[model samples]
Target: MSTITPHKLGLHKILKHIPLNAIFDAPAKARLAKAVNIADLRLCAKARAHKMVFDYLDAGADDEISLRRGKDAYSQLEMHYHVLSGLKPPIDMRTKVFGCDVDIPFFGCPTAGNRMFHWEGETAAAKAAEHHGSLYGLSSLATTGIAEIGEIHKGPKVFQLYVWKDRELVKEVLAKAKEGGFNALALTVDFTWYGNRERDIRNDFSIPPKYSVAQVIEAIRKPAWTYDFLSHDPYTYACINTDVPADSLAAFVNSQIAPEFDWQDAEWLLGEWNGPAAVKGVVRPDDAVKAVETGFSTMWVSNHGARQLETSPATIDVLPSIREAVGPDVEIIMDGGVQRGTDIAKALALGADSVGVGKPYLYGLAAGGTEGVIKALDILKVELDRAMGLLGVGSVDDLKKRGPGLIKRRPASVRDYPDRYAYERGYGGGVI
Candidate 1:
């Protein structure tokens, strides 16, 4: 009956069929809003940040084989799921870190120079940590000082110690950490020299950036990021914002960081802090045992996110052995190539008391500042809860109990040993 009559063209009906969502969705709230996962945030950051800045945050040591393997290794392990066997309701992620209860099993791992990424910087990350009921690791090279971070975040905080050659500066930093009420001190012990981060070399990256004309042109393309960079205070290492010359990160690291650091120095630093301490950058089982012997409260299994040693073993692959060596009691917190909730669960199941995430959170930080970091943690928490439910585990402890038996690594028979371990061990044992 309707076809009998000739109707005028109706703009309203045609417009309704056109789906205005494509025409006017406001470009997804700056793309950061569209990021539903950690990898998405990293992509968003890469798009927003200058290539050089992103490279500084992203690239690893020479060849970057270890860096690539750190993430690839986790993908080799598969988790077994149990059905209808989970606890009644409300799975818990809460756990203790040195007698202090933290709401999540993973905390933000410290990376230096947050201000270089965004104006909000460490403060943004610390606030997100507070909101998420987790800990924040403040770097000694942080743009925000310990006191400032301590003043803002009421949650668990740990100060990362670089053990610079300047002992008085080190003592002053310790004093500041104590005064700042940091719950723990993490001592990074793997920086003997700069790892040949060829990307940084190619970019000619530095702390206070020396902008080339090309870089300026690149910055012009990222107007929003450049706005934040120009409006914010100049980036400087807030922990020791004294007369130290602001130069290349490598130059400062080579000149200031103590290459002669040993166990005695670690012991003295532990004695000085006189609080819960974490010995970070340890990968060997023997080194794990030694860390326990050296009076550290926790052994942080890391390879400086593969920034220090290109040949370092993937941290996750070494975690099981470290756990066996350290026994049941020593808290093993690990960091490197953690991008997903499943990654966190996998690490927990492997006997990590807690996991540390650096680049992922930084990606979120660089993507949306404080809000982005909070969103990133929120995504992880949601994913963790879902994964726990699906895996039929009620708590972090439950995951730990189910972990060893359920998680399996890809067979070495099917794949080559990671390059670092490719040389078959005991090849000349009989001859020796």
Candidate 2:
């Protein structure tokens, strides 16, 4: 087993000089999470005006156990320490995903109807990604088209695909994404019928939106988000709206999206794309392997932030084995529950090539716009640096070799011990 050294000391003392205070507790603001998480971010969203709208973003299918589990999954993994490790030099979160290199191990998942958040909306999120040196996945369903974000950010832009009943729409999006200089495409496979999001059911949040009296009252609560939201250009991506010509986001999603999508669709789409496409919404090893055969350059394991389906109760709990199945050659990217830097280390050590973080940066976007996004990335990067140093490592590459064997799994993670700790399972057993 490797040992800890004194070189790992002073992570906190050093970060003290870096000014995390501005990120977490801006001199002018109160609790940022409360505002961003509740009001400006979600609580005040037009979704609140209509339950259907809320369900689209806030609720989940069935009992929402899976949605709840996604958050809990992160809580289940505990971090251990190597007290005396010599982690003197700073740790770098920098890594290469797909072809382009990223400043950190995390990236942004493409979101739709961003204009609903603010006029700057998708634009704000894209700039935030560039400023942080991370990849931005733009949704085909985005209120903003691929070209807008692609032209703006020089780093990396990944196009997110939603399989439509219209093969023409699918091909058009691919051609547009390619034309716009999108590097890789990620296809979301799990959502057949949009899940029954109870919140949206209650709020009736639509594309153009049908604001109710309560929604108007709800919008009035968050002054800042409301102002920016109303200031935008008619506030929607006509690029997507023109495709469905539906009056509501819900109607468009239901009418145009295909629920009978299968693995064959993956192969067909791959033939059309002619680029390094990845399959999003993967969890099991069989599916990962199947996706690999379907012509995906990589298999991304995610629970769609537990927003789309409720079938799998958790995502993080299953990554270690997915790594073993895909092996080292195929890239494995995961998201859903990466609140801390240590969580980033855990995913990499388990064999994920990289991960996509959703809510954390979304919260940042909601809180302070572009600056908030920067702050969120700063928090994760700082934590990653400190955790790496404490673990006595110098780089993300080195940490991949450092696993539970380097230090004991914290007691809280004991129930997950059998699977997460046994990393040599090869490709058959989940225990790997």
Candidate 2 local lDDT, 1-432, one digit each (tens): 632321134343444455443443242144343332212333323222233333454555676677656654554655565676666665677888887799887877877776554445677788988888988878876777677887778887788888789998788778888888888989988766676666666666554444567766765655454444443334444455454532366667778788788888778888998888889988898989888877789888887777776667467778877888877788878887666777777777677778787766665555555665666677777877877787777887787767645433346535552332111321112210
Per-residue lDDT tens digits for candidate 1, residues 1-432, read: 322111123333444444443222233236877777776777767767777888888888898888778877877887888886936878899998766889998888888888787778999999999998898899988888888898888878888988699889899998998889898999998877777889887987764456677777887777656656554445667887644533446668778888889999999988888999999999999988888898998999999989888889999999999999999898889999787898898999998999999988888887778887898898888888888888889999888877898789877678654433121221111111
Each model's RMSD to truth, in Å?
13.6, 13.5
Q: Give the Cα-based TM-score of candidate 1 against the true structure.
A: 0.88
Separately for all candidates shown, the number of backbone clashes (residues 3 or more apart, or on different chains) is 0, 30
**Per-residue lDDT value at 259 in model 1:** 83
In model 1, residue pairs whose N, Cα or C atoms come closer than 3 Å (at least 3 residues apart or on different chains), thus clashing, are: none
Q: Whole-model Cα lDDT per candidate? A: 0.80, 0.66
Name the regions of candidate 1 deviating beyond 4 angstroms: 1-28, 242-248, 413-432
